[model samples]
Structures are given as C-alpha cells and as structure tokens.
Target: MTVTIGFVGAGGIAEWQHFDIVEARDDVEVAGICDVNQAAASEAAERFDATAYTDHEKLYDGEDLDAVFVCIPPFAHGPAEIAAAERGIDLFVEKPLALSVDRAREIHQAIDAADVLAGVGYDWRYSRGVERAQELLDGRTVATIEGRWWGGVPGDDGHWWREFEKSGGQIVEQATHVYDTVRLLAGDVEAVSGAGSHRLVDAVDFADSTSVTMEHESGAISHVSTTCAAEDHDAHLEVVADGATLRITEEEITGTVDGEDIEESFDVNPYAVEVDAFVEAVAAGDPSPIRSTYDDAFDTFALTMAANEALDADGRVQPAAIDDGTDAGEADQ
Candidate 1:
C-alpha cells in the first residue's frame, strides 16, 4: 500500500531535505503541502501535484495523510505535532522540538497518549561516518569528547533564526545536531555548565559565541562550543577513547584506531536514509529503527535548554531542572 504523506512547512529544510527525498520514493505519495506563506506552499504543491493550504488545520482536515512532516521553526512546533498525533497520523518533526521545555513536554504527553509513530530530524545519526564511529567506539572507554560548530548565522538579518525567542539561539537551533550526536555517542547529559556572549554579530539578539561543558551519565565528559561569527569551519566531533581517537565529520571519519591510522568517507545521503527509515517504520507499525524519536530528541533539547539556563544563571545546572523530572542537582562541583 502506498503511504500518503503531507508536509506542514515548506521551508528550506522541508523542501531540500525532506520533500526532495520523499518525492523520489515510488511507494509514497506527496498528498498535500502547507505553509504560512501561501506562495511557498502553492509552489511546493504545484511541484508535487498536491493541494496547498496556508493553514495546517486546513491541510490536516482536507488530506487523508498517513504521515506528516512538521518542519516549522522552533517556536512554531506544538500545533502541527499535536494535531497529527490526535488524528493518528505518524509524524517526522524537525529538530529543537519546541522553544521551551514546558511546551515540548506538553507535546510529548500528547504524542505519548496518541501512540503514533514519530521521528525527529537528527539526520546526522544516519551518516556512515557516525555509523563507523559508533562501531569503533563500541567496546572502548570514551574519555573525552569534543565537538564544535563554527560558521556564520543561517539566513539573512530578518530571518527568524536570529531571534532567540523564535529559534532558541544557535545552541538549540543550529548546534543541536552536534549536541544530539554527542548524546548518541557518549550518553544522556546529567549536568551542563556554560557561558555565552554576543561578541560580533549585531543582527541577532542571541549570543554570537557560546561554550558548554557537559557531564554524561556514563561518566564521560564532553565540551561543545559554537560560534556564528566565524568563517566556515568543519563542524565535527572528536572522541578520545582508550588508546584511540576518532574524528567524525559529516562526510568522513578519520583518526587512529589501536595505533593504526584509519579514514573512512561517506557517500550516502543521511537525509534519504532517515526518511526511508521513517517510512519503513510507519509501514511496519514499528518505530524501532528510527535513531532520533521525539522522546530521545527531547532529552537533547532539555540539555541545550539547560545550557542556556546555565548561561543565564552564570553557573551550572542539571538537565532535569529544565524538564521537571528527577532533580540531577546543580553542577557546582
């Protein structure tokens, strides 16, 4: 049976990463498209030969979709996700689930009660470089993990991403891929301490450079720093384990493994892999193969939110403090 999918947002990521991939699939039909920008939605619908709607409620009510991809900005997350869950339609949501923890938890509760298949857009996990890195780190004790995202801010000065209230800053908006990868390789973050400052970019209200230190539940240590004011640098992760070091980029993984120099390159498109996995999972009614589920991505979001809170407090804070779960206490040690 062919699965009919609708897109709730027709932004860049939705158009390039998601719609393009799903459009290439033979067993899936692009049923509808929706965006706040009617022109954009109409354009996408024209390309796919699907109906267009300016509001998501109209799209949901008009299209009998098996799944919907919610690719809106961080601040515009809750409604589409909740609506899809309520309608028993599976969902593939973009990263940084919501701008605030409370709203994310509310959406989580709704999704949990509905029990529909759900996936998040942490496509980096499906990269062959990450796969190889995971394989190499399996039996080794990871000592220190360091990751960084150094680049210019996305979009123009008027973009929503530049506003902290709209995008949740660079940490939650852009650096989330690195944070999620760190959590995947290391483990759940127990506590985070960090500092941020608006050094260069005057266009955005948020910080231009931010540094965060995380303590994982498995006793691994990680430091992730991001800057939107610099020239493009390879945003990647380097893991130092017992007698081995692994450096992972989006396209390649290189380093020493057991005193032997090893390098591997990835030609696979992770976005395609991620989309295929979600489609297959929905077809089989089992979401087991999806790397980043809504709940798992929420943990990453909570960690980023905690880092932002720590920056505000000028001290360390536990991830639990932001999520209203068990108290992991302050990171004052």
Candidate 2:
C-alpha cells in the first residue's frame, strides 16, 4: 500500500530532513504541502508533485493523506496535530512539542482519543552510537550522567529561535535534544533545580545559559547545562556507569570499558533512521518501534518546562508537579 503523506511545515527541516528521506521511499508519496508561507509551500509542492496551501485546514480537507508531518515551531503547534488526529491521520511531530504544556496536553488528548499512530522528532535516540552506548550500559548501575549543549546561537539575525516567547528559549528549542538523550540514557526525571541567566546575546531576550540538576526515578543523579555563548566545544552526554564511562556525541561514542579503550563512530544519519522508523510503523500499524512517541516526548517537554519554572522560582521543582490540566504524571505510573 502506498502511504500518502502531507507536510504541514515546509521550512528547513522539511526541506533537508523529512523531504529527502520520504522522497527516496517507493512506498510513499508526497500528497500535499502546507505552510503559513505560501511561497514555501508552493515550492515544496512543485518539487514533490503535490498541492500547496497556506492553511493546513485546506490541505487536510482537500487531500486524502494517510499521514501528516507537523514540523512547525514550538509556538505553531496544537491545531495541526489536533486536526490530523480528528481526521484519524497518523502524525509525526517535531520536538519541543509546544510553547506551553497546556497545548501539548491538548494534542495528547486528541491523539489518545483518536488512537492514531504518532511519533515525535527526538531523532538522536535513533543514532547508532547511542544504541551502542545503550547496549553497553544496559543492566549496569548508572551513577551519574552529564549532558550539555554548549554552542553559539543558531540561525541568522531576527530568527524566531532567538525569541523566548516564540521559540520557548534555548533550553526548550535547542537543548531539548540533549535533554531527551539524558532521559533515554538515565531514566525519567523526578525533580529539577536550576538557574538561568540572560548574560549574553543582548539582541535576544532568551537566556543564553542554563544549568539544571536532575534526580531520576532510578536514583541516579544527572545534570544538563546549556549555553549559546560558546562554539568551541562539543555537545554530548557522558554517563558514568559501574567500571566504565561512556561519552556519546552526535557522531560517535568514546570511552573506556573494563580498563580498555573503546570507541565507536556512527555513519548512519539519525534523521533518516527516524523517518524510516515512523514510515515503517505507520505501514505496519504498530508504533512500538517509535522511540519517541508524543507521550514520551511530553515527559522531556515537562522536564525542560520544569527547569524553566525552577529558573523563575530560583528553587527546585518536580517535573510531574507542574500541572498543565492533564495527567502528564500518569506516564510515570
């Protein structure tokens, strides 16, 4: 069966990651393309032999899509996902689900009620190096995990990502990949205490640096620190396990095992792997292979939001305690 897919956002991610991966598949067809920018949608539609619309409603109503990929920004979520779920269309959403927890909860409800297959864009979980690291650390006692996303600010001047309100700050918008990886390696976070500062990048209001200490349900301690002030270092997760230490970056995992040096590199593109997993799951009618479902991504979302809350309170906060009018904590049970 040919899977007809529609794209709700035709930005860089769609052009570079989703489009390239989906276009290569023989079992899928680009059915429609929609974006708030009409030109972008039209260009993408022309390239893929699909229809273009500035409004997602028109695209959904006019096209018979089996799945819809929502690649919009943090602030542009909610309605598209809800509409797709209402139409019983499978969904693939990009990370940092929404600008607010309430919006994420609404999408969650729609997906749950529809019982449709859904996947989120925590693509790092699909990295071969991360998989190898997971295999090496499995059944081992983890002591501590340290994750960081230290780098210079991304995007050009006046980009939406530099805005706190629109992009949900760097922690939510950029550093979330690291947060998700930490959760995957460590476990579900129980509580967080952190502080944020807007000391750098005067043109943007979002914090340039944030430091948070997390307590996981597995009784392991972890800390994730992020900064958009430096471009000289690498972004990675370092896990300290019993008798060994593993450092996992986007391209490789390096460390020592049993007092011997061991290093593994990844040649596979995680974005491609992620897209393939979503397509295969949709085709097979099983979402089990999806490492990051909307529900699971919500946990990462909550954890980051909790860190933001703590930054505001100048104290500690439980991730499950920040109520968004949904039972987000139920996933822990």
Candidate 3:
C-alpha cells in the first residue's frame, strides 16, 4: 500500500526535509500541495505531477491524500493542523509547534480528540549522533550537559524570521531543536534563566542571539548559548559523566572513555529520517522516533518561553513563578 501525502509549504526546509526524502521513497507519493503563494505550490506540484492549490480546504476536502505535511510558519499552524485532524488525516508539522501555549493547546486538543497520528519536525532527534548520545547516557550517572546552536538569520526567506513576535526569537524558532535534544538526553527541566540582546536586528521583537541556563530534575546541569550572528555556525552538544565526556557536533559524535578518544561521522540527515518515519508511522499506526508530539512540543515551547520570561525578569525567572507545566517544582515533600 502506498501513502498519499500532501505538502502544504514549499520552501527551504520544506524542500530540504520533505521533498527530497519523499521523492525518493517508493511507498510515498506527493499527492498534492497547497501554498498561499500558488506559484510556490505549483512548483512543487510540477515536480511531482500533483495538484496545487492556494486553499488547504481543497486538499483536505477534495483530494484523496491520506496524510498532510504542515510546513507553514509557527503562527500558521493551528488551522491547517485542525483541518487535517478533522479529516482523520495523519499529520507531520514543523517544530516549535506554535508561538504560544494557548495555540499549542488548541492544536493538541484537536489532535487528541481525533483518531490520527501526528509528529513534529524535530529533526535532531532522528540524527544518528543524537540517538547514540541518548543510548550511551542511559542509566549512567549524568553530571552536566550543554548545547549550542548558532547561525545566521534566513535572509533567504525574505527576512521574515527576524521578527521576534512572529518567530518567538531564537528559542522558539530555532534552538527549540537543541532545547528538546537536551531535555531528551538530560532530564526534566526544573527552571529556566535567560539572557538575550538585540545586537543584530533593530526594532524586532526577536533577539539576534540569546543564552539560556537549564536546571534539570535529575541533578544534571545544562546550559545553552545560541546565536545567529556568525557565518560558520551550526550546533554542538557536550556532556560530562564521572569526569568522562561525550560531545556531538552536527556531523560527528565523539566519546572519550578513561581519556581514550573515539569518534566517527554519522550519516543520518535527521530531516530525511523524519520524513521516512512519519510515513511509516502513518502506515503502521504508530507515532515516530523523533516526534515533537504536542505534549513534548508544548514543553519545549514552555521552557523557551519561560527562558524569554526570565530574560524579561532580569534573570529572576525562578522555577516557582513559571506557570507552564515545564519547570521542576518540589520533587518530594
């Protein structure tokens, strides 16, 4: 059986993460595409010989697609997602879920009230290095971990990402991947302390860069410093346990045991893996390996929002004050 998939956005990451992978899969077919920008949707349709539309209702109501990929902006997610859920179409949406908790809750409610599968584009979790890191750290006495992701703003996307109000700054729009990765590898986040500056963009609600400190419940420490001000930018994760260390870069993961070094290149393009996983999940009736499921996705949003709140509070954003069910509270007694 083949899975008919409709793609809703046709841009950089959409192309990078979905188009390339789905095009190569025999079990998946690009059935339709919808973009408010008809030309963009037509471009994707032309490549797959599928239908294109400016209205998503055409895809949901008219087409025979079994699932939909919602790759629109953070703020543009809820309606498309609810549409898919109402139609019982499995969905794969891009990360950070939404710009606010209320919106995420709405989408999550739609998803939970339906009989469909859903996944988010947290591609990092599908990466081989990140998976290996998760595997190696299991049952070990973890001490400290930190992740950093820095890169330039998307001038390629017409600079739409520079607006903090739209993108939710670096935390919601970008480092969300890192935030989710750390929590998956470390533990439940207890509190968030944030610091950010408008060093690069002017009159934008989003920061050009930010630094966040995360306190986890498992007694492990984690810190994150994210910036988009540099050219040779990507991401890296470092973890320490019993004085030993494990570090994962974008393409490589390194582990040192007793001061002996071990490292290798990992081949997974988390984007490709995520697309494949979503299709398989829809077919087999399961969630994915790298899902930013609304539950976890909302947690990521909450943590980052709390971090932003912390920065707004002059770094006094204590754990007790954050109302988002993300921070650590009195663990016992």
Candidate number with greatest lDDT = 1
C-alpha RMSD of each candidate structure in angstroms: 1.7, 2.8, 3.2
Q: Give per-residue CA lDDT, model 1, range 133-167, as digits (tens).
A: 99999988888899998888788868999898899
What is the Å distance of residue 102 in model 3 from its true position?
0.4
Better of 1 and 2 by TM-score: 1
lDDT of each: 0.89, 0.87, 0.78
Candidate 2 C-alpha lDDT tens digits along 1-333: 889999999996998789999999999999899999999999999998999999998888999988999999888999999999999999999988998788888898999999999999998899888899888898888999999998887688888888888898888988899999989988998778888888877866877899988989999999989888885766899999997899998789999887988988879999999999999999899998899998989989988887777776644677743335743232221
**Once model 1 is optimally superposed onto the true structure by TM-score, how far is the C-alpha of residue 186 displaced, in angstroms?**
0.9
Between candidates 1 and 3, name the one with more favorable lDDT: 1
Q: Model 2 reaches what TM-score against the true structure?
A: 0.95
Deviation of model 2 at 213, angstroms: 0.5
Q: Positional deviation of 273 in candidate 1, in angstroms?
A: 0.4
